[model samples]
Target chain A: MSFTVEKTIKTCRGKLLKLSHNSAALNCKMVLNVYIPKQFYENASVAKNKIPSIFYLSGLTCTPENCTEKGFIQIQADKYGFAVIYPDTSPRNVTFPKDCKIDPNDWALGEGAGFYLDSDTLENFQMGTYISEELPQSLASSTDLFEDKIDFLKKRSIMGHSMGGMGALNFYLNSFERNSNGYVSCSAFSPVVNPTAVSWGQNAFKLYFKDYEHEGKKLDPTLILKNKDFSDKNLNILISSGDADPFLENQLKPQNLIDVVTKKNIKGIRVNIEPGYDHSYFFVSTFIPEHCEFHAKKLGLINHLIK
Target chain B: MSFTVEKTIKTCRGKLLKLSHNSAALNCKMVLNVYIPKQFYENASVAKNKIPSIFYLSGLTCTPENCTEKGFIQIQADKYGFAVIYPDTSPRNVTFPKDCKIDPNDWALGEGAGFYLDSDTLENFQMGTYISEELPQSLASSTDLFEDKIDFLKKRSIMGHSMGGMGALNFYLNSFERNSNGYVSCSAFSPVVNPTAVSWGQNAFKLYFKDYEHEGKKLDPTLILKNKDFSDKNLNILISSGDADPFLENQLKPQNLIDVVTKKNIKGIRVNIEPGYDHSYFFVSTFIPEHCEFHAKKLGLINHLIK
Candidate 1:
C-alpha cells in the first residue's frame, strides 16, 4: 500500500498531494492526486469527524493532472471540508501488449482511454475493480496522512466529466451498489450518457470486452440501470450537460439517461442542461461547487446549507 | 484596433473571451483573455456604473491560457463585479528575424519570456508598452460587448504572479505613474521585486536593453522605486510570497521590495510571506481573492464587506 509522493502543492486552504503507487489491479504503476482540505489540518484530534472524500475521474485523453489543474475543485473542497481524489484515466505502463485486442495507436482504446472498466480480454487492466474497490481500499489503509481520518472507502461520493461521467454512473449503479459502504452520491458534467450507443464507447467496449461471456453488457450504465436494484442507493444522483457542447447530440446524449430514469420512475435523479456552456473543463468547473454541496449534504459532512 | 474573438467560454456567472489583435507596439500579434463578469450582462443600460478591470500578467514561459485556466480569477471577478484581462507573456509571429539581441534558444530571454517590457534592442517586442498602454486603448475602443462599459482605462488595476508580478510593480510604479488615468491598485503573488539583482531579471534586462542609452537603468523596479515619486499613488500595493517557493531567495527576492518600502517609508504597501506555498499557480490562485477584494474596494465596485 506504499505510495510515493511526487509533489505536494499548496492550494486554497489545503494541499494537493500528487502520488503514484504500484497497482495490483492494473498490474502497473498508477498515478493519482489527492487534495486534503484545511479542516483536516485544523483538527487537533486525528479521528475527529473523518473527512468525506469525493473521487473525480477524468475523461478521455486525460491524466490526473488535467482535472487537478483545470477543474478548480480544490477551492470548493476547501469550502466544503471534504477531500478530493483525482484518479488517472488509465494505467501508464501496461505490460500485456499482446493480450490487448485494441491497437496502441487508437486514441479511444489504449492507454489514455481506459473507459474505467476491467477488460475481459487478456489485456485486462481491471480499471473498474481498481476504481471501485482496490483504489479506495488502498487509499483508506495507507498510513500516510493518517488515512483512517479520511473516509475514502465508506463515506465517499463520485463525480466525473465526459467519459468519466459514464464510469461514475456505471460504477454507482452496478459495482458500487454491491459494496456495503459504497458511494453516497454521484454527479457528472457533459458525460457520455449512452456510451454503448456512441462510437467512442462502442470502440472502447469492442476492444476491452471482445471475448467475454457477459461481453460489454455489464459495463453499460443504460443497460445496468434497468437490471440493477438501486434500493440501497439513497442519495440523489445529479447530471449536467452543456447545450452548446458539440458532442451533446452524437456522443453525450444525456436525454437517453433522462428517458431511462423517467420510464423506470427512478427516484432522486436530476439532469440539468446548461445553456451556452461547452464540453470543456470550464463547463465542469463552473458547476462543480453545486455538485460538491450536493455530495457534502449526502456524505453527512454538512447538515446545514452553505452560502 | 480590431481584435479577433478566438473562443468565448462560459464560466461561473461570466464568460472568458480569448482574443487576438495586431499590436502596433510589439510589431506582432498579441493574444489575451478577457473575462466579463455577470454584472456587465446584468446591467440593462450602458451607464449603470461601468465594471472595473483587473490586468493579470503571467509568469515566465506562460501564455494567456495558462493563467486563464489555472489562475481561477474568473469566479472572483464575478463575485466582485470586476472584469479581468489576462495578457500573453510575449509576442508571437515576430516578422523581424534579426531585430533582437537574445538567442531564440534561451528560455529566459526570448519568446515566452518577454519579461513584460519593451526592448531597445532590435528584438524588442515592446510588451511593456503593449500591456500598459496599447492593449487597454484597443480593448476600450472595440465595440464587441460594448467594451466601452468596461473600465479598462481609468478605473483599472493590476495583479500578477512571478515575472508578471515584476511587470505589475514596475509598471505601477513607473510607466503607469505617468498616465493621467492609470491603475488604481496593484498586487503580486511571488513577484520578482528586485529584477536587476536576479539572474532572471539580469538576463532579460541585458538582452532587451543591450547597448541602449537607458540600458538596464529603466527596467528595474527597485531602481525606479527609489528614483520615482509615488506621492500621487493612492491605492494600497499588496504582495504575497510563499516561504517554500524555491526561487524565493535568489530569483523572487520579495524582501528587497519590503526593505525598499520600509526604508522609503512608503505608505499603503503590504508584503506577506505565506507558509509552505510554492511557485505554482496554486499559490497564486490561493491569494488571488484577497487581491481582488483590495482592488474592488479601491475601484468602488463594492462598498460593503464580502464574505
Candidate 2:
C-alpha cells in the first residue's frame, strides 16, 4: 500500500507528483501521477473540506506522464478545488502465462493495453481490479500528500481518452449504481465505446481471456449502457469523439452509443462529435475544461456556485 | 516564401498550424508553428482590426515544435486575440566551411544553436535576419492564413526562453529605438543575460565570429541594456529566472541584469527571480500568462482594459 514519490513538479496553482507503488492487484509495480491543487496548500478550512479527486486514464502506448504533461487539466482542477489522478494504462514488468502472453509489438495486447478489465485467467493484466478497487484505497493512505485532506476513495469522478476512454465507460457501466463508492460521474474523449463490437476489443479479448463470451460481455459499455437505469437522473454520462479521428469508422464507433441513447432516450447521457478535431492530446486538451466543469458540478466542487 | 503545412491541430480556443518554409535569409528550409486564435473566426470587423503576433524564440537544441507543444502560450494568445509564432532555434540541412563548421555532436555551436544572430563567417547561420526581419515579411505575405488580415510585421511583441531570451533582449535593445516595425515590448524566461561573461556565449561567439570580442560584445544583453537609453518611459523589459536553474550562477546570470538596472535606476526594466523554478518549459509555461498580458497591453490587444 506504500508509494514512492518520484518527482514533484510545480505546475499552475498545484504540484504534479510522479509516484510509483507496488500493486497487489496486478502483482507488479505501478506508476501514476497525481496533481494536488493549490487548495490543499491553503488554510485549515480548505483542508477540512476534504477535496474530491478526478481520475484521468490515458490511451494506448501512454505512460502516466503523457496526459500529466499534455492534458492541461491541472488548471481546471485548481480552479475547482479538486485533485487529479493520472494512472498508468496497463501493468508493466510482470510475468504472463504462455497461453496468455501476447506479442510484444501488438499495441492492442501485452504491456500498454490492459483494457481496464480483469482478465479471465491472467494475474498480471488485472488492470480493472488495480484501478477500480485497489488504486483508490492505496492512494488514500499511501502518502503524506493526501493525509486525509484529499478524498481519493469516496468522492471521485472518472474520465479517459481513447483506450482509457473505453476503460472509463466500461468501469463506470460495470460499477455505477451498484454502490456509493462507484464514480460520481463519467466522461470520455474519443473513447472506444463498442469494444466487443470493435476489432481492438475483439483481439484483446481473444488474447486476454479464455472465456471471451462470458467475461468480455460483462465489461462491454455498449451492452451495459443499454441495461443501466438512466431514470435515476443523477447518472451523468458525457461522451465526445472527434469527427476527424482516424479510427472513427472501424475502431471508435461512438455513433452506436449515440444511436442507443436516441432510440432508448437515455436521459443523462450526452454525446458530442467535435468537428475538424483529431484523436490526439490537442483534441483532449480542448475539451478538458468543459469536462472538468461537468465533473466539478457533479462532484459538488462548485456547490457554492449552485447555491 | 511558400509554406507546407505539416499538421493543423485544433487546440483550445485556437488551431495550431505546424508549417515549414524556405528561408531566403538563412538559405535553408525552416520550420515554424503558428497558433491562430478563435478571434479570427468571429467576424470581418475583427479581421479588419487585425490580430497581433507574438514571436517566441526557443533556447538551444529546440525545434519549432518544442515550445509550440510545451510552452502553453496558446491559452494566453486566444485570451488576448493574438497569434503565436514559434521559430526554430537554428538553421538545418545546410553545409558550412571546415574552419567555420562545428562538430555535429556539439550542442552549443551546431544546427540547433543559431543564437538568433548572424554568423560573422557562415552564411547559413543568419538567424538574426531570418527571425527579426525576414520572418515577419514572409509570414505576412506567404499564405492566405494571414492574407493582409493578421498583423505580423506592424503590431507585434517578442518573448523567449534561455538563449532565445538573450536574443529577445539583444534584438529589442538593438532595434527598438531605430525602427517603427520593432517589437512593442520584450520578455524572457531563464535567459542567458550576459553572454559575453558565460562559456556558452564565449564558445558560440568564437565559432560564429572570427573577431569574437568586437562582434560578440554587441549581442550581449548585459552590455546592451547597460548602454541603451532607458529614458523612454514606454519601453518595457520583463525578465524572469528560476532560483533552482542549474546554470544560474555561471551561465544564466539574470541577477547581473537586475544589478545593472538597480544601479542605473532603469525605470522600465523588471527582473524576477522565481523560487523553486527550473530552466525548463514547466517554468516558462507557469509565467507565460503574465507575459502574454504584458504584451497584450503593449501591443494594444487590450487597450480597452486600460482606463
Candidate 3:
C-alpha cells in the first residue's frame, strides 16, 4: 500500500507530487498527482488539525499530468488550505481482461476513458471503485506521503472537467448519505451530466459494460438527480460550463441536470454559463477561484486575506 | 500587413487571441499569441486610453503556445490591464537560406533557438530585428488585430524564461537608448544570464553567426552588462532563478551577472534565488503575479484592487 514518489516539483506555496502505487481494487499500478497545500508544509509533523482534501478528476484522454500542469488548480488549492488530488481517469500500463472489449484506436473509449465508474463487465476498468473507494482507503494510511497531515475522510469535495464533470456530479449524487464523512460539495466544468443521452457516454457505456440498461442508469447523474435525497446531504454543488464549449449542445447537455434540479426544486446547486470560454484549460483556470471559494465555504474555511 | 486569427479564447477578464501574420523581418509567416486584457473589452473602440503591452519570450523548443497554455501570465495581464504579446521563438513556415550552417537535427541551433538576436551569417533568422524593431512597427498599424487599442511602442516591458530570459535582459540593455519608445523594465525566470560562458549559449552563438567574438559578444547579456551605461534609462531589472534548477550551476551562471551588478554598483536590479523552485512553468506561474506587478509599476499602472 506504500506509494512511490516519482517526482516532486515545487509550485505555488506547496509542492506537486507525482506518485505511483499498486491498487488492489483495479489490480494494477496506478499513478496520480497530489498537490499538497502550503498549510501542510507550515506544519508537516504537527498533525493536530489536518488539511482537508479536494479530489479533481481529469477529463478524457488525460493522465494526471493535464490538469496538474495546465489547469492551474494548484493556485486555488493553496489559496484555500485544501490538498488537491489529481487522480488518473483510467488504469494504464496493465493488461486488460480477455472477456472485456476495448478500442485501441479510439481515445474516447479505452485507456483514458474510464468515465469514473465500476465496469459492469471486468475488474480491469473498475475506476469507479478505485477512485471513490480503494484510493481513499490507501491514502488514509499513507503516512510516508503526507505524514498524516491530510484529512481524507472528512471535509472534502469532488470536481472534474468535461467527461470528468459527469464523474464528479454522479459521484457526488450517488455517494450521498453514505456516511458523515461524505463529500461536502461537488463541482464541474463543461461536464457530461447525462451519459445515457450523449454519444461519448453511449459509446463508453456500451463498451465498459455488456449493456447500458443494467448499470448505466445508476451511474448517470441526470437520472440520480431526479430521485436524489437532499434531506440529509448538503447539496453544495457548483457547475461552470463554457457557452462556447463545442460539445455543450450534444455531449454535455447541462440542461438535462438543470431541468431535473429545477423540476425537483433542488437547492444550492449553481450553474454558471461563462461567456466566450471554451472547453480548454483556459476556461477551467479562469473559474478556479470561484470554484475553490465554493468548496472552501462548504469545507468551512474562514479566510479573510486570501479566498 | 493583415493578420489571421487562428483562435480566440476567453480567460479571466480577457481573451487570448491566437494570431498569425507575415513577418518581413524574419522573411516568413509567423504565429504569435496576444492576450488582450479586460480593459480592451471594456471599450475596444475607444482608442483614447490604449492598454500597455508586455512581450513575453519563451525558452528552448517552445512555440508561443507553451507559455500561453501553461504560464498563467494572462491572469496577471488581466489584473493589471495590459495585453501580453507571446511572439514566436523564430520564423515558421519558411525556407532556410543556403550557407547559413543551420543544424536541422539540433533544436538548440535553428528554429526555436532564435536567441532573440540578428544572425551575422544570414537574413533567414534575424529574430533580433524581428522582435525589437519590425514586430512593434507592424503592431502599430494593426487596426484589424488590436484596433490601435494596444500601445505597442510605448509603456512596454520585456520578460522571458530560460533562454528567453537571456534575450529579455540583452534586449533591455541594448535597446535602452533607442528612443522614448524603449522598454521600461526587464525580468526573467531561470534565464541564461551569461550565455557566452555556457554550453547552451555558446552552441547557439556559434551556429547563429560565423564567429563568437564578433557576434556573440554583442548578443550576450553578461558581455553587454560589463560595458553598459544606465545613465538616463530606468534599470528596473528582476531575475528569479531556482536553486534546484539542474541548469543553474553550469548553464545559467547567475553569479556572472551578480558580480558585474555588485562591482559596478548597479541599482534597481534585484536577483532573487528562490528556494525549492525549478525551471518549469510551475515556477514561472507561481512568480507571475510578482513579475506583473514589477512591470505594472514600470508601465505606470496603479491597481489597488488587483496587482
Candidate achieving the largest DockQ = 3
State every prediction's TM-score relative to the real structure: 0.95, 0.95, 0.96
lDDT per residue for candidate 3 within A1-307, as digits (tens), equals 7789999999999999999999887788899999998888876433566788999999999999999889898888777788999999888877777765666888898788999988867667889888888887788789878877788777688899988998988888877645434688899999998889989988888887887766888878888877666755557899999999998898999899899889888888899998788898999989888998888888877453342
Q: What's the lDDT for residue B177 in model 2?
A: 58
1 versus 3: better TM-score goes to: 3
Q: What is the lDDT of candidate 3?
A: 0.85
Residues A167-279 of candidate 2: C-alpha lDDT, one tens digit per residue: 99877776755563788899999999988899998888887788887777777777776766666655788988989899998999988888878887877888999988899
How high is the CA lDDT of each candidate model? 0.82, 0.85, 0.85
TM-score of candidate 3 chain B vs. the reference? 0.94
Worst 10 residues of 3 chain B by lDDT: B298-307
Model 1 chain A: worst 10 consecutive residues (lDDT sum): A210-219
**Tens digit per residue, CA lDDT, model 3, B1-307:** 5678898888888888888888888878899998998888778433566788999999988999999989999888877788999998987766667756667888886888889988877677888888888888788788877888898887788999999999898888887555535788899999999888988888888776788767888777777878866655558999999888999999999989999888888787899999999999989999999999999888878643442
Residue A243, model 3: Cα distance from true site in angstroms? 0.9
Worst 10 residues of 2 chain A by lDDT: A172-181
Candidate 2, B1-307: lDDT as tens digits:
8788998888877789899988998988889999998887766547458888889999999998778767778888878889999999999988888666577888888788999988878888899999888988888986577666688887888899999999998888888655747888999998999999999999998888889999987899988778777667467889988888888999998878888888888787888888877787778878998899889988887863433
Candidate 2's docking class is: medium
- Give lDDT tens digits, candidate 1, residues A1-307: 6788998888898889999999888888888999998878876633567888999989988999888888988888877788899999988766655645666676777788989988876354678888988888888888766457888877788998898998888787774556555688999988887777889888877777765326566767777776676656564689999899999999988888788888888788899999999998888889988888888888776663354
